[model samples]
Target: MTGSIDRFDEVVDEAWGRAFRGRPLADRVFYLASELGDFSVLWLIIAAAQGLRSDADADESIRLSLLLLAESILVNQGIKRLVRRPRPAATEPRPHHVRQPGTSSFPSGHASSALAAAGIMSHRHPRAAPLYYGLAAVVATSRIHVKVHHASDVVVGAAIGIGFARLAARVWPPPGER
Candidate 1:
């Protein structure tokens, strides 16, 4: 299994190199996909800031909001700093996207933050978990599809985010004594 994964990585890297060669369209697509992930973080912050707005479960919403907020900060900053992986544009030949000045690519911070929100919301709202994770999957794959990150980066970031969200939920269950 491990060997297969290693081979997969090699194949992906090689394909990325070929696909990205002087391809402006690919670069633009990658850039757009990378920026799109940021929108989820924006939405989460907006929803949390706005609060529940008259829902009977306003208090529950606040508690979950706080959990997600903390998870976002911790997962994004911690994983980015700890892993410090370089972006594909930095190393991979003819990387498709424009490289951000200081964004390290190992375990994509965008993927981590998105997964943290998606995982927590999905777990808290089981019926909607599938949809949430499905969206998260799109966000994760976007990273690779753009060629800014390797498949491994997306996978690890997702694991870290999901693990962190679960831990946060466990340590700080929602209000109303659930």
Candidate 2:
């Protein structure tokens, strides 16, 4: 089973290898995704702006987002330490502006953050669930796109994120709901 999983990881990494090589547009999209998903920056910025303007639901969104992010961070770090899988080896010069993270690559922190934010936001704004999860998917795939993580890593990171989000939500529910 371990060998099969390793082979699958290798195969998927190889399949997406070209995108990190010379394809200009793919490189740009993945780079943007990585940046957008980093520490859940894009979502936090949007939530902050909305909160500053006193928009309805902004406070709850921000609170839930924070909770989800914190929990996901714990999960990501713990899982990474436990798994300790190395990232895929880059064959040649990576595309311009590709950043490599210096952490265990078994569970992608970016993917975990993205999914946690998306899971909480989906409940916060049901109408926007699709967009939230869509961005989460992009973020998860971005980890693989840059060859900083394998497919299984992002998938499990997503699960960890979602699980933590649900648990956090139960502990610190939104106002007027608990």
Q: Model 2: how far is 35 from its true place, Å?
A: 1.9
Best by lDDT: 2
lDDT of 1 by residue, 1-178 (tens): 8588657766877776577634777666555556667635543653465365655346655665676567556655666678776665544454443435265676766677677777666655679777777767767766776667777878788888788778867876654335
TM-score: which candidate is best? 2
Q: How many pairs of residues collide in each model? A: 1, 0
Measured against the true structure, the TM-scores of the candidates, in listed sequence, are 0.68, 0.87
Please state every model's RMSD to the true fold in angstroms. 4.6, 2.2
For model 2, residues 1-178, the per-residue Cα lDDT tens digits are: 9788888887888777754535888878877888777767877876676567555567776695678567655855666778788897776676755666767887878878788778877776779989989988888898888778888888888887788768767987765568
For model 2, the superposed segments whose C-alpha errors exceed 4 Å read 18-21, 53-56
Each model's lDDT comes to 0.65, 0.76
Clashing pairs in 2: none
Which stretch of 10 consecutive residues in model 2 shows the poorest summed lDDT?
A: 49-58
Off by over 4 Å in 1: 1-7, 13-33, 42-57, 90-101
